[model samples]
Target: MQIRVADKAIDLSEGATCASVLAEGLSKKQFKNTVAAKCGETIFDLDRLIPAGCDELVPVFADTPEGLDVIRHSAAHIMAEAVKTLFPEAQVTIGPAIENGFYYDFAYKRPFTPEDLEAIEAEMERIVGRDHSFTCRLVSKDEALSLFKDMGEEYKLEIINDLGQDNYSLYSQGNFTDLCRGPHIPRTGMLKAVKLLSVAGAYWRGDEKNPMLQRIYGTAFANPKDLKTYLHRIEEAKKRDHRRLGTQLDLFSFSEEAGPGMVIWHPKGMLVRTILEDFERKEHLKRGYQIVQGPLILKRELWERSGHYENYRENMYFTEIDEQAYGIKPMNCLSHMLIYRSNIRSYRDLPQRYFELGMVHRHEKSGVLHGLSRVRAFTQDDAHIICRPDQLLEEITGVIQFVKDVAGLFGFDFELELSTRPEKSIGSDDDWERATTALTDALESVGLPYEINAGDGAFYGPKIDIKLRDALDRKWQCATVQCDFTLPERFDLHYIGQDGERHRPVMLHRVILGSVERFLGILIEHTGGAFPTWLAPTQVRILTVTDAQNDFAEACHKTLQGVGLRVEADTRNEKLGYKVREAQVEKIPYMLVIGDKEVADNVVNVRLRTGENLGTKTIDEVVDMIRNDCLEPFKRGGMSYSFF
Candidate 1:
């Protein structure tokens, strides 16, 4: 048999495996780090025999990202072995590698506690020390069922029977065996840098109807330094959890009486939401977008026509309205399309952009809902652009620039992804290709690097998704620009072309700050509740040292408010240190320390929440300092500070 490794052809024995070929071609150091092999687009175990006439083989090393994923997946299996060793009654069902880590699901009588996790981790270390080889074998379905049945693994047996395949792959190490589609590491000894993160209860296969199973989440890295860095980031993430910060900052709350996914916006939280909404409206107007609003519910027939009832019915909330069925909208596109069709448009009026901070509803499952990130009801900074086909790439470019500018406003770095057409999409093949090419061209035009997400686009169109990196270097999905060819066709949308003939228009759906509520949650954690002076719900606090300085503090507060600053007077009957401590806890950006000296000098003593003391300054100087902070990102781009 002939095969290719790194574009070099070599002849091997008919039954020779990829491992054997690599051993002949690669240096010992290179072969030592290799964990898997890829033939074209398919990845297989290194021990798998090379197919006849196989071309273009590549090695997957442990030091690479994909290699780390493979290591983590095998680590998950090793963790399963450790669990089964310590608690022999546990039955493993499925385990797979995900982003940054892996998890295994098992059927157990009770939840695994912290102590159980510790013991299981110790057993995993012992197993790794044994350095057993992970040998794979192909077995018949009946054999797999019987093997699991004999071991009392009802979950595994059920999974094998449900598969209904003639053969299944079983990977075994020492005395432990698991059914998996694996390209695992060669040996248990390769899993040196592994950590068990947490154990949570998940329904079998994520279906609540199925029995609950225990899931252990863990992560693995190629080296100890990387593992240490990851652990340090985890600790930082814990300290910056939005839920805890939301309460400590008195921003938002989730009430037991109000529902799990519903958010109760306190005064401070409402202020933050209002500022963000106003900013979005101003930004849309700056970009020549017409603001529009749509009803919360639309007739079910309209939803069915838009393919929502078919492709998205599960996430929608339906209600009967006087013998007619209507669904609460999960997206704002359908309404925007209706607005475009409300009147006739020509090529001169083709690029009609509609903007709305529209509220949407989705029936999110209880388990997936977190503090504001996933919610049953939330508002999107949504917009739609209707333009001629020639203007498609330009419109997409405009959206990409909009996302870049907004991400810059919050000091966030972002990565872009082009999501291609999915298997069950609604558009024609030509339309899908055109839409995808337009998105790809726009990304290239902007000269930003992006990866493709195959079969992960919206049913109506291809999209460019922007994932933002926060202060903790965690990614949050907050912006997307989708180029739709199906919706306009389905809705029969058309405009008069240059030749005065009716032609179909391309529609674009986009959101800069994807969801208003969710974006606020991210901002809270990103800034740790200490937002910039401009976006701070309360920009400044006037803290008086004693009753003697009360009059000066009140006058100072009034002056600050007169100049358009969101200033508050902390005139509580308390000591100066106490007031400062409280302000620090609330994460207020600037504190005006009003003392006898300040009153006598008729100047403000400023102290930053970050512990920087800016000595006394005149009223005009203080105002200029704050006004500059208020217009930071906008100032850089020559954007108007008119909204503030």
Candidate 2:
């Protein structure tokens, strides 16, 4: 029998199974470069042989993301096996791979303690040392159900019953069996370095109404050293958690009475937010974006027209007024579309960009909300660019550039990802193809590398998502540029072309700092609450050694404030050391100490938050240093600086 595996043809014996073919290919180094394998249209374990007569086989590699996911999935199963061996009664519900790692849900009576995790880790090491082979078996649905039932595993039986097939598959290792559609690793040893990270309470199948399950989150790596490094990074990330730093630096707070996931920005937090929003507003204006405002609540019909009702209704809030239904807007595109249709447009007005610091409400599940990263109500720096078919590529290019400029200002290095059509989307096939091509061409023109995320785009369009690598090497998606060929059509948006014919305007939906609150949260974590000199809420604090220098400190503070710096004088009845420590704790970028000698010399002693102390320097010189620091990413007023 002949088969094609990743565009290569191979011959196999009539009785060969999928596992045998995979083993043969790997021995010949045909699959060394591959991450996973597929038989016909079904994804299969690499250890499985191609059923002889199968005409197609595709090998998947870890370089592609799906291949990595397969590896993570296998790691999850390994972790589960370790858990069950150690606890014995820890009923495993389901374990699946997520974005960065994998999580296993267990119907345990109590949370797994820290000591329990250590025991599980030791057991997992033992299991991996044994290198038990994972044997796959295909059984009749009745047989599979009977097997799980006899074992008193209700969850496994429930899952098997829901599977709509007469013959189902199971993978067994020793006494452990799992009901899975799997492309798992061949042996336990394949998952070499493993760590069970944490435990949390999660509802079964993510339904809040279902039984709560204890979830164990973990990650795995091909190399043991890589696994160690990943664990170190996780520790580093926790130390820099924004919610913790927010309080340590007196930045923000969340009131229980106010509700979870809502942030109340303190004076310092608000100050930083103001600077960020002001910067964004100016950039938008310079880029020919006309600012617009819309009501928070609109008639429900508007959302229905934008396809949000059908696709995103579950995540939205709805209300009824005067016997008419309304919804608090979850996005600004629908409102902007209505604004655009309020008047007629011509070819000369082809690309109209409307910007808004729009506030949107989303009904986020409480369990999923974490600090400001996931929130219920937030503001988006949203913009919609309406253009003709000929202008689609150019509009996308401009939006990408806009995103880059804004991100660079905050010292974030970002990568691009193209999200394609989702399973349940609104547009026609042709529109999806056209919009995807436009986004691809735009990214290519910029010479930026991108990865495609199949079935992850918005309902109305395909999008180019920008993921920023944070200070701790973690990635966060913060910018989006989506091309919508559907919304304009739904709203009947048009522009008179040069040929005097009506044509639908292609809508480009874009956002920089996707949500102000979330971006601020990232910023807090990235900087560890010590923002750059320019963006710091309080750029400098003037500390005086004694009453004799109080007047001088106040004058110096006024001088710095006059130079457009956020400065305050510490004139309280406190020792100089106390004031200096206070300033450092507050994360003020710079601290200026005024002593009698310095006051008389017209100089100031500068102390950095990182404990760098400089001898007294002239006030002008000190101001010059700050100006240079402020110009790090952009040359403002002919001043510049670099990351070094």
Candidate 3:
């Protein structure tokens, strides 16, 4: 038979295996890294016979993202094999590949310690050295269940029963058998450069009621170079850990006494957050947005009307007051809708943008809560654009431009994706289609290539999610521009048009920084807590050499403060080096070191936190230098963007 391989037609024998194709067409060194192939999006093992209906075949190389996942998945099976070999009574439950690695869960005698991980890893290396071929077999559900039951694997039987399938596939290596749907690597010799990372306790199937199992985490790669690079990044990520930096820098903290996910901001942390809030306010004002405030709690009836009761009740907080139930807002849109309906709006009053740094509450799962990234109470740099149908495209375009502008200030490169309406969303087909088209057209007009994310939009509308890649190349979902037509229709929002008819206005819900708290957290890690001058809590710290220069340092501090810079003074009776070291530890942008010589010359020596020194300069020059290092955010086309 004839088969097309990447646009090249070749004569393939009947019932030919992937092993034959690679052996015949590629060198031995090349085939050593060939794990699997995909015949039209369906992955197949190299040893499996090519399906009869396959007209085209694409080889999946080990270096690609898809191929890396395959290697990791096989690595997971290898780990399970090692565990079972070492502990004959241990039953393996489930193992799967995750981002950057794989993990296997097992019903073990006890939680795995560091020594157990080392032993398992050594056994895995031995198994890989044996080079046992992985073989797959199809079996009936009854046969698989009986096999697992006889092996005393309750977890496997439960999973099999839950699947409710008549037939299942199983993979085997050496003497170990596992229930799996796999297109794994053909042989174990290909499994090289694998390492076990750590071990943790996980509830079986993520249910607390189920028995807790030991999960061993590990990772693999196509080559040693890639694995080395990944391991290096892990070390770097530890140093940049925001939780550690948050405590070390005295930024923010969480307490068991207050709550699990609530943030307790210290005085210095509050100053940092205040600057970000002020910037948000000024940006909104310049872009034709009116700053609006909404109540924290509203009647349950209002939530029902806004569809939050049906779709988002699980994540919301509710309370009762005076025999009436009230829901603490999980979203700021409901009150913003009421604002639009407060008074009659004409076409002249169209395209109203209401901006808010609204604080919202959500009942997040305790297990999933992180330091600041995942929190119960956080403020959103949120706004809603209510515009006429004709104005929807322009409004969305402006939002995209706004995101680009904001991301540029921090050197973030973003990728765009148009997220469609979700399965549980509220809206008519027509409303959804129109809203989706508006977003798509806006993206096309700007000439940006975007991927389509199916069914990942807001509950009320489709959106353009901007995933920004930080300095470490990790993507964070920051800015989102959503087209929400459902809210206007559900709320019966209307505006008097030129035709003297009541027309429904379209709503665009968007945010430039997403959650302010989350953004700050990312910022902390991205820059390693050394914030730029403009956003730094202390832009300049004036340090005097001793008591002799205290008055001069006070004068310099006053001058800097008068110039609208966030400055402070350290006039303690300490050595110059100690004060400078303290200022550096604080990550202050500029340190003005005043000494007897500098004070006599009417100048202050500028020392950077990075340890670079500038010769003595007048107070005005230092102030000018600090301001120059500050960020000046602006819109595209050289247009100045306002900030508070």
Candidate 4:
């Protein structure tokens, strides 16, 4: 037999296999100890004889994401095999690859312990060294049910009964046989680098009403170096966990007494939030947006009218006041629409832009509560644009530019996603079509690349979601622009045209910094709590080397504060090194040290967070440096250098 590997063809005698092909010609050391093989697009075990009609054979090295996933999934099956081997009473269910790794669920009598994980992992290594071939077979439903029934695998029988197809696939290795749909790596030996991460109990189908199954979580990599890197990254992420950082920095906290998802912003956190709101308010005013205020609670009828009751009731909180049902506002649009309808207007009043830093509350599941990321209460930088049909393009373009400028100021390169009407929605087909087309055209006109998230839009209209990538390569969706056709029709909003005839107005609901709290969370993580000079809560800290120099430090603070800098005087009698270390820990942008030499010369010792030493510069010179570099937000600390 003959076969082509990557670039050349090789001939082999009868009874030769892929493993032997590599061993004989390539390198005995590489072939006899390899993990998996890919024949064309299909991946299989190296021990499998090259099928008669096969064309090409390529090695799967386990370094790529697809290769790693296949390896991890195979490791999961290996874990299942080890479990069944150790505890014959355990029944295996579905197992699949997730974000970082994979997990397998099993119906068992006792919970798995750390000792059990160790034992299972050891067994997995032995099974891999055995190098058993993982063979796949398609069997009819009746055959699968009878086979598992005879083997006392009741769970497999149940799964076969519920499968939609009459025929299903199963994979077998040694005495271990399990139901699966696999593009699995060649064999157990391919799972070279593996680790058992953790164990937990999961509901059979993620429903509490179903039976509880113990899930074993694990991860695998193609190479040892890659595995080491992943473990280090995991450790770093844990150290930088927002929940822990929030407490250590005294920024915010969630009370177990009050609730799980509710955040109680402390004084420091509130100060940061106030600064953000002020910045947003000034930006909105400059963009021709009229700031508006709305109530915190509204009658249930209003939500019913807005179609929120039909679409979002499950995630809403209802209350009673004076024998009438009311709901805490989950959004600001209903009030904004009501404000628009307060009076009829002519075409001259078209394109009214309303802005609101509105606070909203939504009910989040207890298990999904995360620090700032998933919260029950937050404020939205919400706006509603009501414009004539002819003004839609310009209005949308302006909004997109507004979002770009804001994100650019914050040093984020954002990716855009345009989501179209969902299957369950309210509006005429023509209206939906026109509104979606207008949004796509507007984005194209601006020459922005975007992805289409089909059927993921709001109930009222289509929208474009912007996800900004942070410093660590993590993406966060912080801005959105929605084209709402249903809201205007439902609200019966209209304006009189030049011909004295009623004309329908298009409504656009948008937000920059989708929620202030969520955006703040991302900011903290993005900078690792060391904010840029302009956005930093405390821009400069003046530390006295000793009590003798307190007066000089205070003078420096006063001068900086007078010039509108966020300055603080650290006159607590701490050592110079202690003060510097404290400032670094707080992630302050700049620090100045004062002593006899510095006071006599009328100069201050300056240090930057980037480890740059701007040695003993005059106070006037230092102030001028900060003023020029930190004021223009888009240019602040040089954020725009890489954006283009």
Point to the candidate with the largest TM-score. 1
lDDT of 4: 0.83
Q: What's each prediction's clash count?
A: 0, 12, 0, 2
TM-score of 3: 0.94
Worst 10 residues of 2 by lDDT: 635-644
Q: What is the lDDT of residue 250 in candidate 2?
A: 77
Clashes of 1: 0
Query: lDDT tens digits, residues 1-644, model 4?
Result: 57876566888678767766655545555554455667766776566677677766776656666667677888888889999889899988888987668999999999999999999999998999998778888898888888899878777777777875789888888788888877576667767788887898887876656788899998888777777887887776666667777776788999899887888998767878888898888888888999999999999999999899999987789999999999999999999988999999799998899999999999876544688999988899999999998899999999899888888887888999999989988999998998999899899999999999999998999999999987766778889999988889998999999999998899999999999989998888877787767667788988887888878887888888888888889888667888888788778889988888998898999998776788989989988888766766756434332110
Candidate 1 local lDDT, 58-149, one digit each (tens)? 88888898798889989999999999999999999899998889999988889999999999999999999999999999999989989999
Cα lDDT for residue 239, model 3?
85
lDDT for position 129 in model 3: 95
- CA-lDDT, candidates in order: 0.89, 0.83, 0.87, 0.83
- Give stretches of model 1 more than 4 Å off: 1-15
Q: What is the per-residue lDDT of model 2 for residues 437-491, given as tens digits with 9 covering 90 to 100?
A: 9999999999999999999999889999999888887799999999999989999
Root-mean-square deviation of every model: 1.8, 3.6, 2.3, 5.6
lDDT of 3 by residue, 349-468 (tens): 989999999999998866557888999999998899999989987899999988887888777899999999899999899999999999999999889889999999988899999998
Q: Which is better, 1 or 3, measured by TM-score?
A: 1
lDDT top scorer:
1
User: Sorted on TM-score, highest at the top, how do the candidates line up?
Assistant: 1, 3, 2, 4
